[model samples]
Target: MASLLSDIRTKYNLLSKTQKTIADYILDNPDATILLSITELANYCSTSETTVMRFLKKLDYDSYQIFRVNLAKELIDSPSETINEEIAEGDSTSDIKRKVIKHTNTAVSDLEYSINQKDIDQCAEMILNARRVTFFGIGASSAVAIDALHKFGKIGLNVNGFQDSHLMNIHCSHMTSEDVLFVVSHTGESVEVLNAASLAKENGAKIISLTSFSNSSLAKKSDVFLSSSTNDKKYHSEAMASRIVQLVIVDILYLSVFMQNEAKFYKALNQSRIAVSLNKT
Candidate 1:
C-alpha cells in the first residue's frame, strides 16, 4: 500500500469521479485535509460528505478522521518539516548567524564522512589514461563542469564540458573505447544527463558518475561512481555542499595528474601564461 499522496495519484484513474475530486483536493491541500473536517473538505471539493467517505474507503482508510490523522503524522515526519514555515520578523543578527553556521557545519561533516580514498584513486587512474574526457551537467552543475574543464586543461588533459542536451548527445556519439565521460548530477536522476551517460556507455566510453545518491541512474550506469553528501537541509542549500564535494574531487584529480606528470603540467602552465601575455597591452 502506498502511503504517499503521489502514489495515490498513480492509482486515481480507478476511483469514481466524486472520489477523484476529493483525492485531487487532498493532494493539492494536504495540510488543509489534516486541519479541516469532512464537512469542510466536502464543501471545498464541491462534493457530498458521502463522496469523501467513499474516497477514504478507496484509499483503504476506515474513516475520514483516520485518514486525516495518518496524513498529519506523515507531514510531521516529512523532510519539509525541517524547513521554516515563514521567516521570523525582527530576528536577531546572532540568531541568523547561528542557524547558518549550524547548517554549514552539518553539511561539511556529512561530506567528510562520505569521502572514500579508494574511489578517488580509481577515478584518477581512469581519467589519467583516457584518450579523451567529456563532462555532462546542467543548471548549477554545468558550472561545476566548466570548472572541471579549466582544471583538467591546466594539467595538459583534453576535456570538454557540455550543458546543451543536443550537443551532449552529439559528443557522446563520437566517444570510443578509450574515452572517459564524467557525469555530474546532484540528484542522480536528471533525465538528459542520464541519457547522455547511457549513450556514452553504449559507445564503449568509460563512465564516471558523480552524484549524491548511490542508487541513482547515473551511478548504476557508470564504470566508476563517486558520491558526495547532500543529505543536509532539504533544499538548494544541500546542493551547495554537493558542489563543494565535487570541487574537492576535481582538485584531487588535478593534483594527481600534476604529480604524475610534473613536466607536462609545467609546460601547459607556461603555454597558458604566454598566451595571456600575448593578449596583454
Candidate 2:
C-alpha cells in the first residue's frame, strides 16, 4: 500500500546489494525508516552516504528531502500503516528527543538548498518600498499569512491578512501599483488563492508568493516567488511542515526588511511594544 515501496518493488531486481540493503530497511520498517537522516539511515544499514546517494540515484529521487517527504506521504496513505512502527514504543525519552530535533533539522537543512538568495533580496527590497502590504491564505496557510501580518505590522508596515476567501477576493479591488500582495500557499495551486492573486494582478499590484513549488501557478503569477518545500499531506493539513519552514522565511524577510530601514523600524517596534503593553496588565 506504500506507493513508494511499490515503485521500488519493480526496481528491486535492478539494485545492487548495497542498494538492496537500503531498500530492505525502507520496505520493512517504513515508519522508522522515514524518520532517519541520510547519515542515520546509513548507520542503520551499515553503509556510507555515497552508497545511500547511489541507492537514491537508482530510485530516481531528486533529493533526500523530497524522498523523505514522499515517503511520509505514502506511509500516511497506507491503510495498513500502524502507529507502533519499528521505531518502537519503547524508544527512550532521549531517543524520541533526538529524533524530534533531527526531523526538524532535516527540514530546515532542505530550506538552504531550496531557497534562492536573489529572490529574497528582491522581495525584501519590494516589501520595504511598498506603501501597503497585504497577505492572504486559506486554512493552514492562513495562519502563515496572519503571522506575517503580525510580524510586519510591528515594524510599521501597513499590513492586512484576510483569512476568508471571499474577503480576500474582494480586497483585490483595493490593490494598487504601489502596494505589495504576499500570498502564502503550500501547494501553490489553491483555486481561492489564484483567484485573489489574479484579480490583484489585474489591478496592478505587485505579487509576491511563498509557496512550495517554483513551477506552481501562484509562482507564475508572482513578480517574485519565495519557495519552501514539503510533501507532508497528513489530515489534509497540507501545509503543516511547510508552515514551519515558511515562518522561517517570514522571519528572514522580516529582518531583511527591517534592516533596510533600521532607524524607522526601531521607532515603529518601540511604539508597537508600548501600545500593546497597555493591554498586558
Candidate 3:
C-alpha cells in the first residue's frame, strides 16, 4: 500500500491553496495531528471543515476518518521519527558539531525505515545480472554517481558514471534491456537526469533511482525507487544531509553486490588494491 505521506507529496502540486496549507501543517507535524478531530484539524489549518473533506477527497480517501487512520499508520511506519528543527543562529562550536552529527546520523538511520530489504536484494540481483551499469546524476548527485562508479568498479562490475549532459544522452541512447541505469537526484526533478532516464527506459534499460522523495518524476519512472530522509533549514540547501544519505545508499548497494559474489569480489578487491598500491611506492 502506498503511504499517505508519499501520496500527499506526489499530489501536492495539484492541491488548492487551502489544501496546501493543510498539507504543509500535516507534513510539518505528522506525529501530532494523527489524532486530531476534523474540527480541530480544520481550525489548525485555518480552513473550514468542508475544505478538510475536499482535501481528503482530493487524495482519494473515502472519508476524513480514513485519512486520519492512514496518516497515523504512515507516521508509525516512517523510517525516522526524529522531529526536525531549524538550526539556531547563535550556537557554540561544540553545539554546531553535535547538531550536524546528530542530523546526519538521523538521516542514515531513517533509511532503514524507508527501504525494504527485499527491494535491496532485488536491486542487487539486477545489478549482478545486468550486462552493464550506467550511473547518471546532475549537480551534487554527479559526485555521488562518480563515487558509486569507483566503488562498484573495484568489485569488477562493468560500470560508468556520466556527468556531461550530452554524453549521458549518448550513452543511454545505446543502452538496452541488458543494461541498468542508476539515476541519483535529491529533488528527483533534475531535467537532464529525467531526460536521460526517459531515453534509457525507452531503450529498455531498467532504472534504479536514488532520491529523497518517492513521488518525484524520477521515482515515477524508476523500476526501483530508493528514498532517503531530507530536512534542511531555511536558506540551507539539503546539499550536505541529502548527499550523506546518497553516499550511504551507494555503500549499501556496493556491499550487497560484493556479498553476492564474494570469491570473485575478493579477487577483484585485492587486484585493485595491488594496482593502486604499486603507484604509491
Say which candidate scores most in TM-score: 3
Off by over 4 Å in 1: 1-98, 234-238, 277-281
lDDT of 1 at 211: 78
Clashing pairs in 3: none
Candidate 3 regions with alpha-carbon error over 4 angstroms: 1-83
In candidate 1, what are the lDDT values of residues 30-96, reduced to their tens digit? 8877899999999998989988887777667778777888888878876342222211457577766
lDDT of 2 by residue, 1-281 (tens): 22565455434435777887787678667888778999999999999988998888877876887899888987787634222122346878787666545444545555665667898999998888888999998888888899999999998888887888888888898788998899999878999999999999999999999987667899899999887764332232455557788999999889988998899999999999999999997
Tens digit of per-residue lDDT, candidate 3, span 1-281: 54566555445545777998887678668877877999999999999999988888877876888788877776777745434444578877787777777667765665665667887887899899999999888888989999998998988889987789999999999999999999999889999999999999999999999987677899999999877645543435656777987899889989998988899999999999999898895
Error of 3 at 184 (Å): 0.6
The RMSD (Cα, Å) of candidate 3 is: 4.4
Whole-model lDDT values for every prediction: 0.73, 0.79, 0.81
**How high a TM-score does candidate 2 get?**
0.68
Ranking by TM-score: 3, 2, 1
Rank ordering of all candidates by lDDT, starting from the highest: 3, 2, 1
Off by over 4 Å in 2: 1-96, 231-237
